[model samples]
Target: MAKKKSPPETLLLLPKWPSSAPIVDTHTHLASTFEAYRTRYKDHATVFDMVRAFYHNTTVEALVDVWCEAPVRTVWREFADSALTPEDRTLKWGGIDYWFVMGVHPHEAQHYTDDIENDIIAAMSHPRCVGWGEMGLDYHYDNSPRDIQRSVFRRQLVHAVKLGKPLTIHTREADDDTELILKDLVPKDHKIHIHCFTDSPEFAQRLLDYFPNLYIGITGVITYATNTDTSTVIKNMIPSSLRILLETDAPFMVPANLYNSIPELKGKRLPISHSAMIPWTADFVAGLTEGKWDAERVMIEARENAKRVYGI
Candidate 1:
């Protein structure tokens, strides 16, 4: 019998972005990323420690970390408070500007309650809190009943719209309902982000046509072999007219290209993704553009779009 070969050693290398342009990861889960790192290394590491290790040499200027839990993590206060000033951010987060968005995810829609909403509402007043969301429909899992998802989604939308905050949405396998609710509740000119979009190009076009300020959040998922929708959307849309934002959705979609770029990585996968990985996602997006754009252009455009949508 042939001996089973051992798997290639897993490696995590920082992206070689090839440019000095600063990038902002418009959507990520920082605390979740920290937790993933802690789990992988089995060390009692601080978020600051993770930041220093992963982001020291990268051109990651800022990140919009997400907080979409039901009861709202208490540590959110620590994260938000730390980003209140430049001095504080420099000291705690390695000078990476930290902004956050708060909401209850569609998966947690069943756990939505009045008190929980109050906490999210109060977070909107925090200077470091840039938006409200990641709240939308997720029929793919249907972790919560569809009706409950819709109710909680709309309730959160009402609060976010009333507060005049930007939106970071999460929609999957429920494009029709997501579209209906968004069109019905959200203003046409509202700053909206369809985070980690993997829906069809037609749906993307419709949303783009309706919402002038809405930008599609692209992640490392675009580099996957199994995904064509994301690349199709990039190809069909004119690069000059691209309304897209680069995000990692970190601790989730580590760009598949990372594995291919480094010889030592072989078939191993990174345990977590972070803001510094935006350039890899940008590089993949550039490939989809058929030479019309490059990694640096993608980074610059995404940074501009992040400012337009989140004002960060």
Candidate 2:
């Protein structure tokens, strides 16, 4: 008798989830993840294959793939054709419709120039580009001087406002300045999201009160046992209905619980995260809701919320 074939190695590495739960990953870095996967998987991996593998267990149907530093042209060339187009309209991520956000991150503030601004202006004309960001302050790293970071962020904010597109912000130790600039510049009618929010409840409340269209994006950070603050903010501060959304911020914040489950990645120097693990984060949110909200309800509303804010 012929020997039976073994299952694909990917099966063992992925987390299990209920297929009935549909999720939309509101923010991700698929371009960076694509590069990482290409290097690791070599000739064997395509983005389609990566999506297929990701969809096997989780119910993530759509994702907004964001780029912080790379030019919008590069982002579009990599994902728009294979990933952004929808296989079906109703399903959203059912066939995983993809979208993108473009901006210069604070880290690259030193490089921000007229040429960069022009590139962003030209990119705004693209149909698939729905939002502007992964931009804001990061005083902790201060990778770029504080003055430069503020200037670059304000420049992008001006363009994003002019374009009538939503803004995705990344604020760290520089919350005070972030709030000041945003409050002064971005109109209350325009949408803004604080992506990967790990700030205090006071900060969350301040932003929500200041920006009528502001939304909080929860990532895999809440899944880490050490991240009680994020979970607390989600449970008490953020509105459960439509003002919140889910994201992976992939190739960065993998769900801590799921990360621990994989044996091979336990001691690895660096592990990879992708949009596929959204269900893990969603489940964590459901738990934080404490029977007040279920995973499906949260995911569905978040999907609609993303659609509204991102204009997808």
TM-score: which candidate is best?
1
User: Relative to the unseen true structure, what is the C-alpha lDDT of residue 94 in candidate 2, on a scale of 0 to 100?
Assistant: 35
lDDT of 1 by residue, 40-156 (tens): 674336988778667777788998989998888989999899888889988988899999999999999999999999989988999998999889999999999999999999999
The models' CA-based lDDT, in order, is 0.88, 0.75
lDDT (C-alpha) at residue 7 in model 2: 32
Q: Candidate 2: worst 10 consecutive residues by lDDT?
A: 85-94
Segments of candidate 1 deviating more than 4 angstroms: 1-10, 13-15, 42-44
Report each candidate's C-alpha RMSD, comma-separated, in the order given. Answer: 2.8, 5.4
User: Candidate 1: worst 10 consecutive residues by lDDT?
Assistant: 4-13
Task: Work out the TM-score per prediction.
Answer: 0.95, 0.86
Instruction: Give the Cα RMSD of candidate 2.
Output: 5.4
- Clash count of each predicted structure: 0, 5
Candidate 2 yields a Cα-based lDDT of 0.75
